[model samples]
Structures are given as structure tokens and as C-alpha cells.
Target: METGKSYFFVGIGGSGMMPLAMILAGRGAMVAGSDRSLDAGRVPAKFEALEKRGIRLFPQDGSGISDAQQVVVASAAVEDSVPDMVRACEVGATRMSRPELLSRLFNDSVRRIGVAGTSGKSTVTGMIGWIFDRAGRDPTVMNGAVMTNFADSQAPFASALVGEGDAFISEVDESDGSIALYNPTIAVLNNVSHDHKSMEELRTLFGDFVGRADAAVINTGDPESAAIAAGLDREMVLTFAVDRDANLTARNLKPEPFAISFDLYIAGDFRQTVRLSVPGRHNVENALAALGAALASSIPPPRAVPALESFTGLRRRFERVGEANGVAVIDDFGHNPEKIAATINTLHEFPGRLLLLFQPHGYGPLKVMRRELVAIFAQKLKRGDMLVLPDPVYQGGTVTRDVTSADIVADLAPAGIDARHIPDRDAAAAHLVASAKPGDRIVVMGARDDTLSLLAKRMLDDLNR
Candidate 1:
């Protein structure tokens, strides 16, 4: 949180690390770091944007860490055998995990809003940030994905906003049990599902998270979240839902291809009819979560609702790249079952045949949720819908690859789904592009890898030809 200190990030280009580095640099700290992606010549535009903001980028070699005074920030994925960690240890530099530093900055704020859940965290975080910005709160925001509203040519990766206000908004992570680190003035729990952790472990983590906050914005529509909300004090909890009853509810649901609209109700009275540029009934749930957060932060319904109308959404959360030759290509961060279901269901609302190319984020997650993943695909994918899977993303780490994308495809075969496992991502993309036809939607889905966006663009280009 020190403004004048020097900090070096080990994986600066990562979704979580990039934004923290940007926040530190924006606050007048000397920020420098290295990423394996940068060294491997991937996502050059992201690193270039960092350099433009006066952040120095270095290769992942040990050369980046020299001064003992520099604080080295690394994610959990970065092993001790990595060159950066080795150099930091040899130089006696201060070391901190990415979540440790982020939690420090978050806990220091006078008014903090922590968005947490298995899915919709990034979208809800972006929505709350945009609401605050539009309401003239000038809140500082940190997110895991690029908020398209804040993105432009100069700041293409606008995941973090450095503000002079006391309000700090961030999406806290629960995958690594780091959700406990955040202490929020207003906590938003969107939903709880199976992803990266067991149901029991997730309940405890999310319970403790909302329990620490002075006020909580919870999704009562989700059974797990509703159960947690049941235990909390009624006066401190603001609940939202799409179905059934809650403090804040959405009615008259109407979903479109790229957008959705619904009526917002507060405590049994209709407040306003809300429309989001982002698609899905799930996003309507996310909007209610953001409205609950804004309400907790003392922002009026009029101000928050108008801001959400203009909310453009995050980069990879069902982002439509472009349509070419009558085929539409979408890039999505749908690695988990819950998120993937949202994307697939949203698209199914329309009449297009889905050509899905899902790249598993990592082998570890594939191993954990293989059954759920296969079940969701089997249940959701229609008869004509085609699915192709590439090998799980492995970034040279020591991991147990007991399960792979091939396993998911094999499981789907029993359900009569047309699924294929293509090991190479390029080959998968080629297959998807070749299979795409008029009125077909080619969706490139995954997380943890930045190159997926580029692949989506390449598919659009090929379709155009």
C-alpha cells in the first residue's frame, strides 16, 4: 500500500497480478515485473500497455530481482523453483503472495466492497465499479477481467481503476482460500457452486467472508447462498434473486441475443425496469447483486440503475468478437460448470446452432470437476450443437493430470453429444471454424490463458475469408 516503494511482480501479465501492478504504478509506486507469457511473446499488447503506464517489464529471468528493498509479488501458481523466486530469496527481498498484497490494500480502505462467488464475480465487480463511477463516488476498483467500459486504445487493459475516493471495490478470490483475507465494509456474495473447492469448504469460506462485513449483498436465488444468508442478521443482509422472493427481485424477464431486460423490485415494490447490455438471466441476477451492493454503500436506486444500463460488460464474459460470413464468434471466460452453463443457456435462448470449443483452464480443475463438466455439457448441448475440446492448459508446472479434456468428451459420448477432443488448440480452432456455418455461433471458451481472445479473433478472420 506504500506509494513510494518499489514492487516487482513475478507474473505481471496474469489477470490478478496485472491489475494490482497497475494500481500500484498508478499510485506513484515504482512497478516492474516479468511474466512467462511476456518472455514467450504472447499478448504483447498487454505488456506494451503496462510499459506505457511507466511500468517496467522484464523477462522471467532472475535479472528482474536484484535489490533487496524491492517487494516481490508472485501468485500461488508461481513455484519456488521459478527464477524470480530464487533470485528474490538470494537477494533477501521481501516476498508476498498476490492475494496477500491485494488484501492489504483492500483492508486499508475506509469503505471496501468485496465481490465474491464461484461465478459472476468479475461482472458484478465491474457493475459496482461502474455504478460508483457514474454516481460520482470516484471509487478505486480492481477486477480479474478487463472492464470494457474503462477500456480504450490508450488503456486497453483497464482492469484496475485508481481513484482518490475512500471506496475500494474488488472481486475477492475463493479458489485458493484467499477469500478470507478480504475484510469488506460491504460484501457481495453472488452465488456458490462447485468450482476449485468442495461444497463444505466453499460454504465456510463464503460464510466467513460475509460475516466479517458490516453489510452483505447476497443472492437468495442460489440455494447455497440463501442458506448462508439465513444465518446472518436480517438487518445486515440485502438479498437479491431472479426467482422466488427476496428483498431485491427481478420480474418480467426478457432475454435477447446480446442483452437482457427485467423489472427490478425492492422489498415487494417495483423500482425500475433494468436493461443490461450483457446477456443472460444470470446477469440479471448479477445486476441485482450490484444494486444490493450500491444500496449497501448508500447509492440510490435511480443512480445505480442508470449506470447499469450503460454497463458494457467484461472482456471475455460472453464477449462477441465479430460476425463474419454470417457466423458469430464469441470469446468467454467459462471454465467452470456454472459459468459455462450461463453462456450456453444464454446462447440457447436464440436460434443459432452452437459450435463450442472449450479449452479447459488447467488439468487440476479438469480432474476435480470432470463429472460436473461432462454432465452440464451433456444436459445443455442440443442435438445439432457440436463441441470440441483441447487439452487442458499446462504452463510448465508440476501438476497431476489424472483427467483431461478427452475424459469429458468421452463422458459426453454416452449422451449422444457430438464432442471431439483435439489436443492442439490451433487444430481445435481450425475445426470449429471449418464446422461453423451460416447462423452458427462459434464460442471460444476458457480461462487463465490470454491467447484465447486472439484465437477468437483469428476464427472471425478465417470466417470472413
Candidate 2:
């Protein structure tokens, strides 16, 4: 962290890796990195953003690790199997995990706040960042998603902010065991669901995460999170909820397509009634989490309210990609049952023939949540709605052979929700556009793949054409 230290990242284009790279490069460090897949060339937007600030990109051929003193940073994904990793060991280079580097920087800061959750991590992270940003805390914030608040000619996504203030706030990941690395002043856990790893592992990781924090904010509605809140070191835990009693809660709940308005109640006394720009009960839950996190971090209720109001929602979270011929195209990252149900449930609020085009993230997740996916679509999808499935995304990694989106479709089609398996995404998009009526909504859903958003936009463009 001292001035001018050369840092080489193994998997630099990852959402987590990109923000850290930009932060370090912005700090006047010599940063360079590599990735295995560069097909879309979209990662260049990330590295080029860093390159604009003087960082360079190289192939993962060990050239970036040439300097023995270089700090080689990478994620758990970057194993000793990779050449850069082997080179780092060969050259006696100081190696670090992405989270470890982030923790080193976070711990060095005078103040730090971390947000951790399974579902609302990005949205909550964006909310906390906005609250502090508007309060003139000018805190350095690292987020997984594009925060539209700080978009300007210089930084569009605003994933990493260079704040003048001492507070260093970030959204830490418990799913990947990175949350264990962060020692934060405040930790926010929105809710823990099945995303990565098992509940036993997540419990240990998230429990340790909140234990290290000066204060831990949790969602009492989720049994897992509530248990974690109860288990954490006493007097440091702050709870937020919509139903069950907690330290800070959002009561008098309401939901709408345009926004969700609710009354905020902290401990016992009545707080301010606020309206979230985003829709859904899930977002209402997200607001409570953000509200609690910001309040525990000492952000004034007045300041946090306006920041939350001005928030424009995250990209691909029930995002309206485009509309053509009266049919709306929506793009969302809802590969899991909880996420998928949330999106479809929101769509049900508005009047339309819901046409869903879903591609599972991977074979492993498809197998893990196979029954849940079937139930989500079967339960939420109306008789007026129809679902189309494409094959799980494959990038030549080892995957379960038995798992496929088609299997889920077969399971759901029998339930009579108008389910069909269309393996090719392009064909599925075309089919959706062709079959969609004047009042139909085409929702493109999946995660771990950026092409879902692009495909959603393309589907709209094709429909309009």
C-alpha cells in the first residue's frame, strides 16, 4: 500500500477484481493484470478505465509477474494451475487474494463499513455508498454493480470512489468466504440464501464477518440471518425487519410498480415514512437493510432518506431494457429461485402477458436448485404467462451432466405453466419476440453472464425492427 508498489492481478476482470484494480491504480500504484477469457473484449472497458489512469493489461503469460517485488493478487479461482500463480511462486513474488488485498487496504483506512448479503448485496452497497456520498462523507466505496450516482465523464459505473473523507466503505462477499477478511466498523447482512457454498459454511463465514465489526446490522426476517445476529458477540448486533421485531424495522409496508412506500420504525419510536424508487417487497427489505446500515454508521436519517430516494436502482435488477410494439423487454439477474420469484412477482403487479426467457447460470446451480426453480416458475407464473428456457451456460468447465435447464422445463411443463425448453438463447429470444403479443412482457433472466442484458436489448431491437 506504500507508494508505487507494482500489483499484478490473476483474474482482473471479475466484478470484485475490477473495482480493487481501479482503486489501487487510482492510488498511484503500478497495476497490471490478466484474464483467461477476453472474447467479448468488454473487460477492456474495465482495464481501459484503469489504463486511463496508467495501469496496463497483459496476457497471463507471467510477464506481469516479472518483477520479483511485484505483489501478485488474485481470487480463489486463480489456483496454482495458472501460469501467473506458478510464476509468482517461482519468482518469490508476494501473492495475495483479492479479498486479502481489499482487507489490507480497508484495515489501513481510518474508517470502514462493509455490506454483506446473498440477494441484495449490490443494491444495498449502492444505497450505503449513496447515503455517505450525499452526506459529504466522500467515502471510498467499492461495489459489485454500476452505481449510477457517481456517473460522469471520468467514472461511469463508479464502482470505486476516491473520497476525500477517511471513511472507507465497501460491500464484502460472504458467499466466496471473502467476508472473513474484512474487519469493518459496521457490517450489513441483508439475507443469506443458497447462492454459493452451504448454509453451515455460510453461517460460520457470515458469523465471523459480523463478529469482527464494531456493529452488525442483520435482517431478522431470515431465520439464518436472525440466528447469525443472535450468535454474534453481544451488544454489537443491530437487527432490521419488516415483520418480526428487530432493532430497526420498516413497518406499514406497501408495494407498487413505480415504488414502495413504508414507515420506518427504529427500536420502538416512529421514524420517517419513506418511499423507495424501486419496486417489490424484496426491495422494501433491501431499503430496511440499507437504512439500518447507514443509520448504524451514523448517517443522519434526513440525509439517508434523500439519498435512498434519488437512487435509480441497479442495472439488470428488474431493469426495463426496452419496449417495442407495446411489449416490454425486462432484463434481470435472477438465476436462483428466490431472485427469480422476486422478479416474476414484481411483474405480476403490472398487467401483462408475462413471457419469460430464462437461461440458467451453470449446470451446477441448475442441479442444486432444480426443484426450487421448478416450483418458482410453477407457483409465480400465471396461466397467462409462458416460460422459455435455454441451456445452461457452458465455458468448458467441469459440470454435472444430469443438470440442464431442459430438465427444469420438463418438471414445470407438467405443472401446466406453459413451459418449453429452447436451448439456444438467440432462438429463444427470437421465439419470445415472435410469440409476444401487444400486452406481453419478455423477461430475460440469468446470472454470471453479461450477455443476458445484451440479449434482452437485442430482443427488444429485433421486436422493434
Candidate 3:
């Protein structure tokens, strides 16, 4: 319940838990954690970084919890049956959910901003943080991906940075309903779409997230977010959009193959011409949401717009891995139905046959959005489009094996999509590299695995050779 305590995390290798553990370790707390993945040899580089931070790693076998004084923290993904969780409870240790622990520390900051959205959350989080950093305003920023702007020798773009300044910025989650814990000075909602929760649940969670903030910045173009904007008190809401009348809107949206550019407008008056190093109209929309957050923090448009242009984008979210011998390989973190459609739809504006390599994140999620996923690929992919799918990325969690990429392939095949399941990363890469032509965009798509980008780059190298 207090500071200066030794803490043990059940899933330390998780994106959310690792950053929080690192912050706790940096704050001089004795922090150690364990993960089933660490034993499985996934994300070994991340574990090495944590070890360098003086945080020891352990197996998720409950052996790490040696004393009652050591608090145990874990994510909702960690089951009660997990050995670490069982062991922590056996020792009468205090346990906290990842969000619960983050809230306690995050709420203590003078300026806490939570960016909530189904997609574009990571990119918007990174954009806001970069604005603050470029302005010389040291702010603690927590993001899901490595922000290119924050990539440097000392931090190595650690997903989160604990700055010496008063501001605390984090990407909140409404899909898991963990966003309820956040009490923020400014809250930004990018857009609402399905992944883990129902639309009804998401609407309430996102609406309530905005209500908890002193001021809410929302995307007016999105119907779900616009509904939240309408219900908010005039003084409490700030809206951004590309079409509708909003406090901030991007007009003249021009999207190219590799990047998107638009003009920013406020209340029908022209503000500035904004350019993004990232592609798609979705990214342009993301930039507007980020601009609103910076404006809410009293950072001028001049500073925010330049920072947005300077943004090289996050680790995923349409990240270009390599362009070997004119074959461009992209790595994107788009697993859900809507997000997948958006990425595919946007690539239509570019110059290439959309050669998509989709690895489902898990069997359960792929099953949950099975029909929608099938329809998206069937609708978006063209005649010559190619799809390479690996089996669902699952290590331990129980899932119905019947529900898989094969199911999606079966559905897509009926619609004439050249889709097949390869079931392994290496074969998928080899097949893609061998088949890719000069104008094919070889995109590796999925989430939860940090090494997908590396695999995408390797595929590009193989194609070049």
C-alpha cells in the first residue's frame, strides 16, 4: 500500500507490465518479475534489457515470491492458476493488476493525459510525447511501441520513459475496460472499434473515460466518438475531425503511397498544412487527435505540427521494414477486423499489388471476428492480390484449434482470394520472398510478437538476394 517495497510481477515480459516494472525499478524500488514467455524464449531481447536495469527475471513458477513484504503485480492475461499468481497468494503477498498499479503512480503526476482508442492509440501516444519532448518539456510517456523520435542511445526507445517533468502520458485501454481507472487532466479518444469487448461496452467505457477527465479531446469524424462529443458539456469537450465541423479538422486530405498530407482547420478557419511520414487517411485522422491533445496541453500548433511532421512513426502501425530490390516490405500491427480493413483499404492508394502476410494474434480473437475478417479480405483484396497466413500465434492460452487461419482461408478462397495458411513464420517468409514481384507490397501483419518486424525485414532481404 506504500512506497519502497520489493515487487514481483507475474508476467514481466508483457508490453504493459514490463514498462511499469522498469519504471518502478528506476524509481529505486526492488522489482523482479517472471513470465511463461521468458521460458519459451520469445522476446529474449526485452528480458535482457530488463536484466540490465537490475531487475532479475524468473520462471512463472511462484519461486520469485520469497517474502510477504514483496508485492505481486500482474495483468488480466495472467490467470489465477498461473504458478506465479498461486505462489504470490500463498505467501500472503499484495497483488495488483497492471492498470491498478499504473493508476496509483500515474494519478500522482500533476498533468496526466490518457489516450484511448481501439486503433491509432499507440501512434497518437507517441505523437503527444514527442511534442512535449521537442518543446523541452520533460514528460513521462508510456506507449505500446518504440517511438522513433524517442529512439536514442540511453533509452533505446524503451516503450515508456519516466521523465523528470510533471506530465504523465499513457495509452489507455477501453477494450479490456482498464481505462476506467484513469483520472486524467486531459483525455483523448481516437476512435472506437471491436477487438476484446462489445461495441455497447466500448461506448460506455470510452464515454466514461472522457467524463473522468477535466477536458476531453475526441475525434468528431467517428460516430462512436462523436456521440461522446455530443453528450459532453461544451466546456469539457474539444473535437477534431477531417469532415465534420470540429474544433480541429484536417481539410484537403491528400494521401500518397508512403505518406499522407492535409491542412489543419479550426472551426472552419485554416490553421496549418500538416504532413505525416506515415501513410493512410487513418493516420491523418490520428494526427488530428494528437494535435488536439497537444493543443489541450497549451502547446502551440507551430510546435505540434512540426513534431507531427518529424514523426517517423511507431515500431508498427504501417512501419516500413525494408525495400530490397524495389520490393517494399511493411510490418503492421493490425489484427482486428476493422483495423485490418483500414490497412488494406489504405494501401489501395499506393502503387503495388497488396501481398499480405497475416498471422492471427490468437485463435480466440481470430475466431471472434472470423466472419468479419473473411469479409474484409474478400472485399478489399484485388484479383492478383496474394495472402500468406501463418497459424495463430499461441504459446499457452487455451483456444479452440478448429478456429484458425484455415477457417479464414476457406472463407477467402470462396471469394477468389489467393489465400493459404503456411503455419510457420519461416515458410511464410520464404514463400513470400520467392513469389514477390517488383511491384508487390509484402506486408507482414499481426500483433503481440515483437519479432514480426525482424522477420519482415529478413523476408525483404531474401527477396533482394
Candidate 4:
């Protein structure tokens, strides 16, 4: 957490790690790191972007850990066999997990708003950060996705904003059990479902997360979160919901093809009619969570609700790639069952056949949620819609291969869902383009792989051809 100290991140180019590295570098810290993707030239532009910010780059080989004085930071994914980790051990360097580093920095802030949930963490964090920034709070913000509102010529990857304000806003992780590390002035739990852990484990983690906060903003729509809210002191908890009665709620919900409008209400009194450019009912829930947190920070609903009107949304969350030949394509970062369900449900709100090209983010995640995912897609996808998949992304990690994308397809087949496995995204894209008809909405969904966005654009070009 020292401003002027040197730190080395093992996987620096990752969405979570990159933002923290940039934040430190902006704070006058000597920041440097290495990534397998950067070393393999998978995403050279990301590395170049980091270098432009004065961050030193190194190969994954032990080259970066030259001195013991440099604290080596690594994500939980970085195994012991990784060269940088071995080098840290060899040099007796102070090694810190990515969460620990983030927790230290986050806890040091005068005011902190921790956004925690299974899904919508990144988007809600971005929304809250944007509101605070637009309200002239000048808050330092960290997010897993790039905030389009903060994007500019110099900072294309505007994931982290270094501000001079007292408030520090960040999306905390409950998947890796890192949410317990943060003690926030306001904690926001959007929803909790099966993602990286079991329901029991999630309840324990999220329960502790909210319990430690000075005040908590709970989502009543999510049963698990609502159960947690039941135990909290009424004075210490603020509630938001679209389903049931709550302190704050959204009523008369309207979902359009590319946007949704809802009447914001607090304690059954209508506050304002809020319109979000972003698509999906899930985003409506996210906005409510963001507004609750904003109110927790003393920003009123009138000012907070207006800021959501201009929220352009984060990258890959139902982002429109382009339309060609009257067929529209969207790029989304939905891998888990909840996220995938949300995306599919959102698309259903409009009248169009869907060609869902889903690339599983990781083999491990697929193995964990395979049955639930199969059930979700089977239940949500209409008869006219089709589901396609490449293989689960293998980024040179050791994982169980028993559960493949083909397994999910097999499970969906019995449920009358037309699902296919192509094993390669390029092939999947070609098949999708060939099968897509006018007015079909082709949604490319996944996470972990940065190339998904590029693939989405490629699909648009292919359709145009």
C-alpha cells in the first residue's frame, strides 16, 4: 500500500490485476509485471497500454523478481509452479495475493463502497463509481470492466480512475472469498447465486461481508440476499427491489430491445421515472443497488437517479457490436448460469430469434456449474433459438476435462433445446453467420478470454459480407 514502493504483479494484464497496477502507478508507485497472455503475444495492445503508463513489462520467467525488496503480487490463479512465484520464493521477496493488496489499498481509504455479488459486480461498481464521479465526488474507482463513461483517447482501458476524493469505490469479490477482506462504509449485495461456490458457502461469505460494513444495501429480489437482510439491524440496512416491498423499489418495469425504463420508488412513494440506455431487467436491479449505495454515501435519489440516465454501460454487458443485413450482433460477458440466464432472458424481452454462441470461460467453472448451466439454457431458450459453443477456454492451466462444452449440449438436447458444439470459436462464428437470418440476434457470450470482443466484431463483419 506504500505509494512509492516497487511492486511486481505476476499476471499484470488481467482485467482485475491491470486496474490495480494502473492505480498504483498513478499513485507514484513503481509498478511492473508479467502475464502469460502478454508473453505469448495474445494481447500485445494491452501490454503496450501498460507500458505507456510507465509500467515495466517482463516475461513470465523469473526475470521480474530480481530483488527481494520488490513486493511480488499475484492472483489466486497463479500457481506455485509459475516462474514468477518460484522467483519470489528464491529471492525471499514479500509475496502478496492480489486480494490482500487490493484490500490494503481499499481499507486505507477514508470512505469505501464495496459492491459484492455473484453477478453484476463489475457493472454495479462501474455505475456507482460513475454516479459518484458525476456528482463531483471525484472518487477513486476500480472495476473489472472498462468504464465507458471514463474512456478517452489516452485511457482506452478506463477501468481505474485515480481521483483526489476521500471516497474509494471498488467491486469486492465473494467468489474467491476475498469479500471478507474489505470493511466498507457501505456494502452493496446485488444478488447471490451459484457461481464459484455453493449456496451455503456464498451465504456465509456474503453474510459476513454485510455484517462487517457500517451500513448495507440489500437486494430484496434475490432470496438469498433477502434472507441475509432479515438478520441485520433495520437501522443499518437499506433495501432495494423490483419484486417485493422494500425501502426502495422499481415499479412499472419496461424492457425494450436496447433499453429499459422503470419508475423509481422509495418506501412506496414514486421518486422519478428512470431510463437506462443499457439493456436488461438485471441492469435495473444493478441501478437500484448503485442508487442505494449512493444514498448510503449521502447522495439523494434525485441526483443519483439522473446519473443512471447517462450511464452508457460497461464493455461486453449486452454491448451492441453492429448490425448487418438486418441481423444484429451483441457481445456479452456472461459465463455463469445466472449471468447467462439474465442475458437470454433480456433477449427474450424482444421479439427475435436468437443464435447464442457461448464460450465457456474456464474448464473449472464449467465443471462446477455444468448441470445448472444446462438447465438454465434448456429452460430459457425458446424453440426457435439455437445454442452453439466452442470449447471451454484453456489458457494453459491444469483443469479437469471431464466436463466439456459438448456435455452441456448433450444435456440440453433432451430438453428440446437445439445446442451444438463446434470446439473452435472461429468455426462457431462461421456456422452462426451461415445460419443467422434477418432480425436474428446473435449474442456472443463468455468471459476470461479477451479475444471474445474481437470475435464479436469479426462476426459482425462476416454478417456484413
- Candidate maximizing TM-score: 1
User: How do these models rank on lDDT, best leading?
Assistant: 1, 4, 3, 2
lDDT for each residue of candidate 4 in 1-465, tens digit (9 for 90 to 100): 457899999999888999999999989999989999987888687788899999999999989888889999997678999999999999999999889999999999999889999999999999999899889999999999999999887888899999999988999998788888999989999998988899999999999999999999999889999999999999999999995789889988899888999998898888788999898889999999999999899998768887988999998888999999989999999999999999999998878899999999888889899889988988899988988999988878677798999988888878988899999789998999999999899999998888899999999999888
lDDT of 2 by residue, 301-322 (tens): 8888898988878777888877
Best by lDDT: 1
TM-score of 4: 0.98
lDDT of 4 at 459: 92
**CA-lDDT, candidates in order:** 0.94, 0.81, 0.85, 0.91
lDDT of 1 by residue, 344-458 (tens): 9999999989999999999888989998999999989999999999998988779998998888888888899999999999999999899888999999999999999999999
Stretches of candidate 4 above 4 Å error? none
Candidate 2: segments with Cα more than 4 A from true spot: 37-47, 232-234
Candidate 3: minimum summed lDDT over ten consecutive residues — where?
149-158
**Candidate 4 structure lDDT:** 0.91
Q: What is the lDDT of residue 434 in candidate 1?
A: 90
- Per-prediction TM-score to the true structure, in the order listed: 0.99, 0.92, 0.95, 0.98
lDDT of 1 at 61: 87
Please say which candidate is ahead in TM-score: 1 or 2: 1
Model 4: per-residue Cα lDDT at residue 35: 92
